[model samples]
Target: MQSDIDPRSLIGRKAFDRDGTKIGTVDEVYLDDATGEPEWAAVRTGLFGRDAFVPLAPSRVEGDALNVPFERALIRNAPDLGVGGHISPEQELQLYRHYGLPLPGPAPDAPGSGEAPGSSGSAA
Candidate 1:
């Protein structure tokens, strides 16, 4: 989450929840298409578990672990946006709502341009 930390290096690291519960391993890092900043991380819950997307803004890296400030169940139940490409604006909003995180930037339906917040595309 810190500017000094490389997003690419986050892959494969272990992630923990607020109560120090082991969630899973970081499977991928999603970068903001507009700012090119690290925005989300897809964690592999288990061998058969699907990858869950976690916000990177509030998450921090300590040593080799990624400390996520949310409950393990919340993280595990995140919307299945799937991995390996950009996260569309609509999908991003669903994630924000699911986490109860305040929406960033302008309102999604703001007039003027057709594109909404995070409409550019996410890089994983």
Candidate 2:
């Protein structure tokens, strides 16, 4: 469910897990290259403030905060791909696998069965 809130507006918002445990502050939001949809968020966590990428599929923007359904521990261990960089497809796959979440994007349910629509399979 996409919230009316712009992902950019989510920056600096505090994020909490389903258990109401404060996870961290949203440092950045990553959008899908194809759809331009908010796909992942880089949350500043840990004592030294590390940025970890968390999937936004199960997250909701509530007022000034983002509510994620995952546990605090899980989010704390999420892959740290840093902030302000292009996330390669391989990196995206790693993130999804790390969280045990089905890979999202074109034909996410079928795993290796699909390519980005209208992006390929054409002859030059």
Any idea what lDDT model 1 has? 0.87
What does candidate 1's lDDT look like per residue over 6-105, in tens digits? 8889999999999999999999998887667888999999999999999999999999999999999999999998898889888999988889988777
The lDDT values for all models are: 0.87, 0.74
Tell me which residue pairs clash in candidate 1: none
Error of 1 at 6 (Å): 0.8
RMSD of each: 3.1, 6.4
Clashes of 2: 0
User: How many clashes would you count in candidate 1?
Assistant: 0
Residue-level error in angstroms, candidate 2, position 17: 1.1
Error of 2 at 40 (Å): 0.5
